[model samples]
Target: MPDRWDCVRENTEWVCKSTVVANTKEAIIILTAKEIGPEDSLAAYESHLKTPRMVPDAQGRPQKSVIKSVVSRKIAQHTWLDGLQLGSEIPSYYTRYLATVKSRLAILVTFSAHQRYFTKYSGDFFKAVNSLRIVANSDLLNPSATSSLELGGSEQIGPGQVPGFGSPLQVPDLDTLPSEPSGAPRNQQLLFLIGIIIAVAGIFIFLKRK
Candidate 1:
């Protein structure tokens, strides 16, 4: 995974965006680790999971929306990961959040176009995330498990150093996928080339006649 440097990126957010190419479809996942206060995640998640309550619009009429349940698990000693399945309108995709124990770090991971790809690659996805580590120990972040990044140059970059972390999961096997264009850019280019060739031929004939 490569870290993207842009205006939106900030010191608190360690965001890495990856494009996954599969046999049938293309998808993207954005991994974010943001610094937060100790134990801030639970409160935030509870607030988001609040029951469906109606608030009035300008017309004083009430507007309502469905509220979904939140699911969670302990990823490490104190570290945790939470997931909330979305509404029927957006089935097949869920929102997820993670907090590292004692490190005051929060992680956000989302899978897009999930309905189209999850069934085929769920195994690989889970297996890959297991490689995620959240400890500060350099020894555990061994060279064998580390991967090289192209953020600046060719130097290798390991996972962020938190307090305690390790996993049986490995880096995802991201299959290379060719992106598709909305239209045939190749055909358009071919037509442009033919037009130029015809123009050149006409010019050559005109000059010869002259």
Candidate 2:
């Protein structure tokens, strides 16, 4: 997680928001993990891309989800969609669904925001996604296993760790995923905050000298 994001645990879900853009409630990211069985498959989720189900928009009008694209890599699948269409008076709602499996563990991450404000905070969202890592420790592969994250980046579970239970489920076989987005900014808000504090201190020092 980015240092500038506020994250909280709600049962099995981790809800996160960019501190700088916290005012926009739609600027959020949610992550959940669970053990899967042989019956669960990525194909089941892909079916929705072919045939979308209607969902209510902000105005309470029914609209079908718009499929943007699908990206797949070894043990991972990505789906981008516009959940709500852009209207004359309402902004379009966008969401990215990312599912990854390793052994018996399946992880799902959802990133969402209104189209009007997505670009402003997209860097943080993508960074969070790219940072995810799967731990191979044996202790984490059981039903009673638990994990926690620290605030700083040095901790093993702080930034890129995924939380979940273990299973004997089977996952889809796929080729290697493409490289992550290299251009995304990291800890941007933290740097910006530091700059502001320095400027304020400089001004205060000048006034004190006067």
Candidate 3:
């Protein structure tokens, strides 16, 4: 965890929040792990990524969820999703989902930030995500073989040395963010906080299907 960031672990998920930003505009990152079964294959993940999605807005109205980008790396599949309304707290949000399977362990790293601040803090978010490593048991056969997901390659940061909290995660400019009807400053932090919660929940829900 980075300085000024607090994390809580529940079963297979870890949710971390940055406190450097105001409470109204915080940033969040979630890491989740699952035990993969024989049926869970990388091809399934790719298909899911290519599928279109419809998300419910704050008013309970359905809206199209857009996949901004998708990348299939040797060891990991990365997807960027945007234009999803996560309820009143987060009228609009952005998410980067990095999925990989290593040693029969399926891992998903999710980073969420207010659409307006995502760009600013993305560096730290990705650094933390890429720093995660799974050490396969040496006794297992085919020790030389690696997982299909290539989650490594970034400069690693040591324990208790997570990326700093001073940056944003590549959010759009404030002007581009939706404002309240009354013209009051929106509570952007809630968007990030809620995004983390929904993301963790969604991960478990989806993993159960694998």
Candidate 4:
């Protein structure tokens, strides 16, 4: 894989595929992983952005703006993700997320194309980040060919991917899901007749014995 500093992580690789990438408002999105540092919070990294940074802009020189960040949440020592909004008026946003799972604080940083774009796409981004699971014991640094590649997680199939029991899986009744087969006639009527025949035969046997 290409070792682009802005897109790849040291321990794990991410698939940040999207259908949106353009010069338009918040059109480009990028994700990169770095070693979790003492600054586990998003605001913790604002000092780094104090210096002016520039990006390629076909229109003109890259806009220089004071980078300001907002911490979405910080749970003492549990899980937290902070958002950064760069640029003025029409802005750009970045999401910095960290989770302390079993003494390991995995870090993920995102660069949003635009603040407006980030807000529009934040829902999916939050969903993706919140669902992250890391296997601290497994060989995440290097996996065999048979090893399944997924975002660091413990969920076998994810939030709504189990049989009859995911966020998206709700069965109100037997009719909601296919048991034996779909559109197949049930044998309840035949079974009821058979049950009645057995009951009548048992009654006759009891009277004969009496």
Best by lDDT: 3
Residue-level lDDT for 76 in candidate 1: 31
- Residues 141-203 of candidate 4 have per-residue lDDT tens digits of 221112221111222211122111212111121211111112222323222322333333334
Per-residue lDDT over 1-210 for candidate 2, one digit per residue giving the tens place of the 0 to 100 score: 677777666554566676765264546666654544443356644443345445544456666555555555432133322122121112244556665544444455566655555565667766765554444333334433323221111221121222221111122322222122456544444333323333333343345545
Report clash pairs, candidate 1: 131-169
What TM-score, computed on C-alpha atoms, does each candidate reach? 0.40, 0.57, 0.56, 0.38
Provide the RMSD of all predictions against the true structure, rounded to 1 decimal.
22.6, 17.2, 13.2, 24.5
Pairs that collide, model 2: none
lDDT of each: 0.32, 0.44, 0.46, 0.32
Error of 3 at 39 (Å): 4.4
The most accurate candidate by TM-score is 2
lDDT of 1 by residue, 59-100 (tens): 445544234444556543444444433221122232233323
lDDT of 3 by residue, 168-195 (tens): 3333334342322222223233234334
- Indicate the residue-level lDDT of 57 in model 1: 30
